[model samples]
Target: MPITRRSAMTLPSLLAAPALAQPTRPIRMLMGFPPGGPTDFVGRLTANGLQDQIGQTIVFENRPGANSVLAAEAVARAAADGHTLLFASNSLAMNASAYARLPYDPTTSFAPIAMVATSPNVLWCGTSQPWHSLDQLVAAAKAQPGTLGYASTGNGGNGHFGGETLRQALGIDISHIPYRGTAPALLDVIAGRVPLMMQTMVGAIGPYRENQLRPLVVFGPNRAPELPDVPTLKELGHEVPDSGVWFGVLAPAGTPPPFVMRVSHALQAMLEKPESRAQLASQASVPAYLGPDDFAARIRTDVTNWADVARRAGIRPE
Candidate 1:
């Protein structure tokens, strides 16, 4: 039997019971990015918290390749005994559309446990550019279409998706300059090689604070606390899609409901702690806790949304 939202919501109470079965084997939390990245930081944070609650060692495994497709597929095909888990991010959702055929279904390959946190992407411009606000940037782009270029981590990544969505919504022409990763792309933006970029706050905050990059807007419901003065895309009068990056935990599809509930319960408790939230803040993320059902729904929505964006933008697998 699969765990439902109703039963999973009682995980905290369930954990209060003295006689709970703990995992005999070590738990593995696998992610796509290498260590030192934001995803890795959040994964380890959650894993540590889980280890404390579950009374078992949790190992973090990084399998960096193809924007987490490799890690996600590995977990999808792993034993569904709840010992192996995936620390999923928006890359999984974007890959659903970006790739022509994935080894596993992004929506169905794994069972969602809970969403750990979300970090909004920031639309930034180089100080060399004169556009101070998103409105000014749009106006400039409209005046000289395709002259303004934005850099992203790569084709079909969240940064790419954010830039594409903004292009379509505002009906402007801006050239996309995809780089190997966010670091190189951000460096170019700061060096004035690229005029703008829609990058994650975690990756861009340091440069922005150092006066190297200027943030115009963020892609979320509200402004980022780090950039409280900046506005969101919606506030700028644009119906841009919410393309922020979110991190979540998932187990193999056939994992037993009780086992799934146990992990989810542990995560829910950990997220409620102040220290956990502080740790997330250090990673430039905020707790966006969603139970299994809601997390599943979010994945389904993202898969659909990104697929549509890719189809309309004519983005294809590499």
Candidate 2:
């Protein structure tokens, strides 16, 4: 039978019917950090909002190791279905420069979804430390040179990079002490094992509030709302602005465009919720929602920027 215009239109609709009829499944959000860390904390929070809006359970799977390479590789290899997602942070962007070789291409291995939020890295000193402010700390580091030790969550983490940047910018020689994680580093700082550390605002807030650690400066363009008393690095004559960690979502490359938009829209809707905003604020994080294009651009910019920092600091991954 010859197809008429009406039948042709109906044929197109028939082809689309199966796609529309497919049942939605639970989305798996892969996080590269262990539970209770900043990345995992934000991942779980965002997952809750996503689940609420998408009407599907968002399961969080932790595949932490090798500076998040394990999780990144897993997500990179996963099918480009909307059901699997990756919750990533600055580490993913930084790894491009930090590691000499990686199994996955950070820029092209995944489809950028949305930038979730940015948080400052708090410049903290042990409560027992003599330095009262950032200026005092810088002066002390200059005076002591390599004797002044600063702790980091790990060798290639944001905290380490932040500390390294400060060292290079201020022309100081503070020693870098690597810890397994931020909690252990914070504990060591509180015990006066190390004099200083650059920690995420989420991890440092409680210690700062309790006076276990003194926040001297925040690596943000402006003072964070939770730490109004603390000055920014820029305020202290450092040109460094907003060199902190950011969290974002990504899907394996080649995921259908509709699926990407669906997840992105769900995240944007979640960010608009009053409760979500409140929860993020309570952790000293400001919610930032950057769509796919903008988020990918930011990632590229950061990778280049941190690469320079790594070069200046003479850091070479082992």
Candidate 3:
């Protein structure tokens, strides 16, 4: 059955369901991005926590291609036996609208286990720019219209969605410059090739602290502890969609409820640990756990929200 908000849940127990034996082989968790990036760091942190709780080795393999569509499709087709999983970011939802047709449904193709953490995307600009704040940048864009542009990791990534949403809400005319990776895209922003870039906290924190990039506003539920001085979109009096990148796990659909719950409870226990939260804090992410039901609902809602934004913004699927 598809995981829903109505799905029954309980505290994790090692022996809660002994009828289902743990997989004898190492569990494979697939993601779209290659190792050494922010996603890999988060995945490694999670693997360290889940390995001990689940008593099984987990391997995160990189299947990078087409904004993780390739990886998601693989997970959707894998055996629904809880042995294979998708370690996804918020891009999972955006993928629905980013593409014309996906082989699997973003929400229903798999069973959501839990959301491990969320990293807010901040608006970054070079110090050379005249706009010192998000409001000033908006005003400048309004005055110049198409003269300004923003860069993102790619066409359908969170940065694209964020930039477009900001344009739509504030009525600005900034073009989007997509790059294959954050390193290149960020370099452009720092070089003044692009005036603004909505970047993940994890990816932008280093440059920000080095005084290479200036953060104007944050796109998240609440202000991040690291950037306490920065104002969130909510604080800025703009009701933007929840487009921040979140890290989570999901099992292919048809995986037994017991198997699904097993992973969910393990994630809950992991996130509940102080050390785990500390690790996330180091990465510019915070613990934001939502069990199977809520995780499913969140993915569903995000997919809907991104699609609506794309429709309103006339963002055609690639």
Candidate 4:
């Protein structure tokens, strides 16, 4: 027998439907970076919070390569049933301008859930280096242009562009030495092979605390709470402001609107927890809660902002 329209329009039956039908299944969160990086660390923390809040297991899958393009593609191609999500970061948005072509469109290949957190990047030098502050470092770089080399995760990474932006902004010349990852680059800096590098406050915190690295200036409007003594680039006489890194959640494009909203609400609840807030603060990250539309707007703004930075720095990635 054909179902009647009056029966299908019953509000009680529709209202009884589960918001997340697969509530018991393990949710897969994909990370573009490797295990020990900030992205992985924060992703795991977020998963833990969500697991406790949503009463489901959240698993993290690491697919590290090609500047996180592999993971982004995997998430973009995954089933849009809300079980699979991407722990997207600045790399995804920056790649839009860094790479000439990508397997997926960053802006449209995924549904924005909520921005997890944001942290400033710090310009740090090896402890053994003579320069102690931004002013001193710029003075030395100006005296010997191209002699002071810095290391970054890659040519088109945030650290790379941040370094280049500083060079252009301060009218100094410094050679950039790109590495496969921040770990190796940080090692090089510690060994004095590379004079300096810009890294996330989270990543630099341990090294700085251990006395292996000396922070020069953070690339943000205000100093990082974890490193309150460190001055911002703008505070050091540079006009650069609000240069930081962020992490967010994304589902594959075409994901059901109901599922996306469910996931977003779950994440918002998790972020509101006191434990989650403490975890974020411990990593020097500020929690940023934005709904789908607002998060999408942020992505667009970031793409436009970083595209200009890349263009000005003459960064054309292959």
Best by TM-score: 3
Poorly placed runs, candidate 1 (over 4 Å): 1-13, 16-21
Cα lDDT tens digits, model 2, 1-318, are 123466445433432334432227877899998888778878899998888766678899998988898899999999887778899998998887778898898889999988988888888888898988877887887777789888988887888889888887788889889999888889999999888888988778788788798888888687888888888888878876356888889999988766666667667767877898898887777788887889989988888888888887888975
lDDT of each: 0.85, 0.82, 0.86, 0.81
| Candidate 1 TM-score over all chains jointly | 0.94
lDDT ranking, high to low: 3, 1, 2, 4
The deviation in Å at residue 61 for candidate 3 is: 1.1
User: At residue 149, what lDDT does model 2 achieve?
Assistant: 86
lDDT of 1 by residue, 1-318 (tens): 233587666766656533333556898899999888778888889899988877779999999999899999899999887689999888988998888889999888899988878899988988888988888988898889889899999888989999889889889999889999878988889999899998888777678778999988899787898888888888878877788899999988988777776777788778878899898887678888887889999999988988888889988877
Q: Candidate 4 local accuracy as lDDT? A: 0.81
Clash pairs (backbone) in predicted model 3: none
Error of 3 at 141 (Å): 1.2
Between candidates 2 and 4, the one scoring higher on TM-score is 2
Q: How do all the candidates rank in terms of TM-score, highest first?
A: 3, 1, 2, 4
lDDT of 3 at 16: 57
